[model samples]
Target: MRQVVISKAGSPDMLRVVDVPLPEPDPGSVRIKSAAIGVNFADLVGRLGLYPDSPKIPYVPGYEVAGTIDAVGSGVDASRLGEPVIALTRFNGYSEALCIPADQAIPRPAKMPVEQAGGFLVSYLTAYASLVVMAGIKPHDRVLIHAAAGGVGLAAVDLCRVYGATIYGTASPAKHDFLRARGVQFPIDYRHQDFEKEVARLSDGRGVQIALDPIGGRSWTKSYRALSPTGRLVINGVTSLTPRARRSLRALLRMALTTPWLRFTPVRLANDNKGVVGVNLGHLWDETALLREWVTQLLAWYDTGRIDIHVDRTFPLAEAAAAHRYLHERRNTGKVVLIP
Candidate 1:
């Protein structure tokens, strides 16, 4: 098998394609032949050595894949062999072959294409969990989504629309039309406008009921302000600015001194009832079955045309570096992929 490995963390250039022995399925594991791999921001963080839970250097960096079950290990049901599935792997997905626990592999929707299925599980699951489960999204709710043209952002839009929430989205001006066409009523150009003010204006002083913010740090305060009373702020990723290697001693001191002060801002939150929460899908391995259940729901929705996976681009397996660069640069307006 051939896989892309970041021999040392630095930039996309560190990704190296190398041949290795195909892994065998251990007990309670399933071997799969990957057809498409989802490229994500987590992969970029891994390359930069900034992801909190990533392994050491010289490791594969992908987290999700869509493929076929080639073999099943002991204690696994024999019927699972030869089944089409999509998997949520912590890493090691940038390859033609994979071995994962059976529970980590979600059965693909009947007749769903490999590419869409490959990219569907992670982002859509996050969107579903954040918008519905975490946010308690309700009918006629007002919502704001940052990075609204990206993978999880778009998925949030689709699922929120299904929940009948009115959406205001932030994206580059070039993606405004795309977002509008996808049910975003107010599309703000984050580069040229203050999204918080826009959300306030669009909601007519009421503010959004729920805000989905994947970009973390101080910029996230704006999303919190965009919410309404009892509105939940669901944050999933820290893509804002960039993930730093290590904080300087002075920077650390400043954070230690000022971190708690931000909460006291008089103008913060929505009507004194808003809340902030985070969703880290990679850290949800303890609830892997729950993720599979969400994947099944997303695939079912896709089958019924209630949602869609916008595959902005697909690169060959050897071009995983380019894929990472494109995602990190925010050039793709939708999910990116690697065809192995």
Candidate 2:
């Protein structure tokens, strides 16, 4: 088998592809012959040593994969062999083949393409956990979504459209048309305009009912301020900390300096009648039941055509470093996947 390893924490060049022995599944686990692999910003953060939860150097980094079950371990159903599925992998998903617990693998919708399925779980599940599970989004409510053309951002847009919310999304002007077609009612050009002001202006000075921000640092503070009196701000990432493809002590120091900006006190929340919540899907690995339930619901939504996964591009597994570079540049408007 071939695997992409983060030989060290640095630039995308640190990602190295090498041949390795195929892994066998443990009891209650199954082996998936990788068809397509999901590339996430977390992988880029891990490659740059910016993610605190990342494993040590020389480890594989990947979050989700879609493939077929070619082997089953003890206690696993032989009937599962040849089943097409999509599974969340803690790591090691960059390999040509991987072993994962059986329950982590969910049956992929027959109509969902292999590349789309590969990119599905992490993006949609993160959106589901934040909007549906946490925010309880209602019809006609105004919502602001940051990075509105990115994977998780588009997923949130689709969900908001289904719930009949008025969406205010922030993206580059180049992507405003794409976002508009995807149901973003108001697309703010973050490159040229202040999203906070735009959200305030577009909502007629009332702000929005919900704000979803993945870019942390001072952006969190701004997103929080863009909310209405009883609005909730849901944060899921800190992409602002990694302004480049490589590690920078200066960026770390800047993040440390801006940490106080995110300090929300109970007294402040009480007085303002607003709320702040954070979500990290990687931290929920132990909660299999909850993840399975969410994945099932997302799959149902896919099956019914209530939502769709947009794949921006596909790269071969060997070009893993290039994939990281592309995503780091933020040129993709949707999911980026790797074919094994």
Candidate 3:
């Protein structure tokens, strides 16, 4: 089998191709013949050693892949063999083949295109879990999504439209037409304008009922401000993870004093209905049933054409470093897929 190994953490150039013996399926696992792999900003963070649980050097780093079931382990059904499937592996996705737990692999819709199936499930499930499961989005709700042209952003826009919500998205101006075409009513150019003011203006001062923010930093405060009195805010990323800002001594002291209390602020029983939730898809697999359920819904959406994900670009596996570089530059408007 061939895989991209991260022998060291730094630039995309550090990712190297290597050959290794094929891995056998462990009990309850399924071996997949790789078709297409999804490249994400989170994977880049993992490769750069910025992720909190960064793996040891010489690790395979990929989160999701779509492929065919080539074999099944002891506890898995042999009937699953040769089935098209997708799985969220957290890591080790950049390879010619892989064996993962059977439950982690969901059968791809027979009618869904292979490339779409491979790149679809992860981002849609993440968006669905955050918007539908955590936030309990309702029709007519005013919503705001940051990075609206990215994979998860487009999913959020599409899903919000399905639920009859009025959607507002923040993206580069060049990407606004794409967002608008996808049903986003207000597409704000975050580069040249303040999204906070734009959201308020677009909503006529009622404020958005929900705000999905994966871009963290000073943006956190603004995300909070964009919400209505009972609005929910979900934090799913910290691209702001890099060195950028430092707090004043007084601010640091206040943060230290409030940290413990702030951590529990999102409790559903709290008197304040306004909410803040954090989502990490990797951690959700602890409840395999939930992951399977979400994957099922995503596949159904793709089958029905309720969600249209524009795959802006794709690269063959050999050019993964170039793919990573493109994602880092933030130039693409949709999913960046690696065809193996």
Candidate 4:
């Protein structure tokens, strides 16, 4: 087996591929042959050591892989062997082979290609948790999604569309037409136009019923302001604070200083009847029943084609460095994947 490891954070070239012994499944676990691996911003964050949850240096970084179960644990049914599935790994999904708990091996939708399925779970689940669970999105409500051309943002747009909510999206102008076709009713060009003003203009100055913000820090306040009275603002990420594929202490400190930390007074939220919601999918890993419920719903939606994964591009596993660089540069408009 081969795995990509980050010895230290400097540039994408730091990601190294090395051969290793294939892992064997433990009791109640299964071993899978990785066919495709999901490349997420979180993976890059971990690789660059920018995230607190990132493993120590010289670590493998990845969370989801779609492949075939080649081995099963003693307590598991052999019937699972040779089954096509998507495995939710804790950290090491970039490896060519993986051994994970049997329960983490989920049935992949037959219609979903391995390349797309590899990156499906995280973005879809994050979107589902934010819009459906936290926002309690309602019909005819207004919604704003930052980075609407990205994975979770696109998923949120589709979910909002299905629920009959009007969608406001922020993206580069190049993605404006694409976003509209994907159900974003109003696509604001965040790079040139003032998204807040545009959102207000589109909403007739009433503001959005819910806003999904992953940019974090200073962006959080703007998203909060974009919300209507009694609206919910969901913060899930801080991509705005991220630097390129490097870990500089000075850059990290600068991010800390420039990023606006949410310090809401109880009186304000109560007085306006407005709410802020924070989501960290990593923190919800232990809530198995909750994760399962949401994932099952997403899978059902995928099987019936109510929603689908759109892979922006695919790269060979050895070019993990290039993949990370592409995502950090924000060149891809949708999910990116790696084939082993």
Tell me the alpha-carbon RMSD of every candidate.
3.1, 1.0, 3.9, 1.4
* Candidate number with greatest lDDT: 2
Question: Which candidate, 1 or 4, would have the higher TM-score against the true structure?
Answer: 4
Residue 110 in model 1: lDDT: 73
Each prediction's whole-model lDDT (CA): 0.83, 0.92, 0.82, 0.86
Residue range 218-290, candidate 3, lDDT tens digits? 6766877788888888888765442212113453344345333443354632665678888888777668898
Q: Estimate each model's TM-score.
A: 0.92, 0.98, 0.91, 0.96
lDDT of 1 by residue, 1-340 (tens): 9999988877788899999999999999999999999988888877777677999888998989999999999999999988998888879999999899988887877777788877887788888889888888899989888899999999999998788889999999999999999999999999999888888888889998888888765556777767777888888886753433322345335434533346735466444877887788888876976776776677677888989788899999999888887887788888998999
* Colliding pairs, model 2: none
**lDDT tens digits by residue: candidate 4, 135-210:** 9999999999999999888889878877899999999988988898888889998989888888889888999999
TM-score of 2: 0.98
Q: What's the residue-level lDDT of 221 in candidate 1?
A: 70
lDDT of model 4, residue 218: 63
Instruction: Give the poorly placed runs of model 3, Cα more than 4 Å off.
Output: 242-273
lDDT of 2 by residue, 113-193 (tens): 999999999999999999998887898989999999999999999899879999999999999999999999999999899
- The alpha-carbon deviation from the true structure for residue 64 of candidate 1, after best TM-score superposition, in angstroms, is 0.4
Query: How would you order the candidates by lDDT, starting with the best?
Result: 2, 4, 1, 3
Let me know the TM-score candidate 3 reaches against the reference structure.
0.91
Clashing residue pairs, candidate 4?
Answer: none
In candidate 3, which residue pairs get closer than 3 Å at backbone N, Cα or C atoms, i.e. clash? none
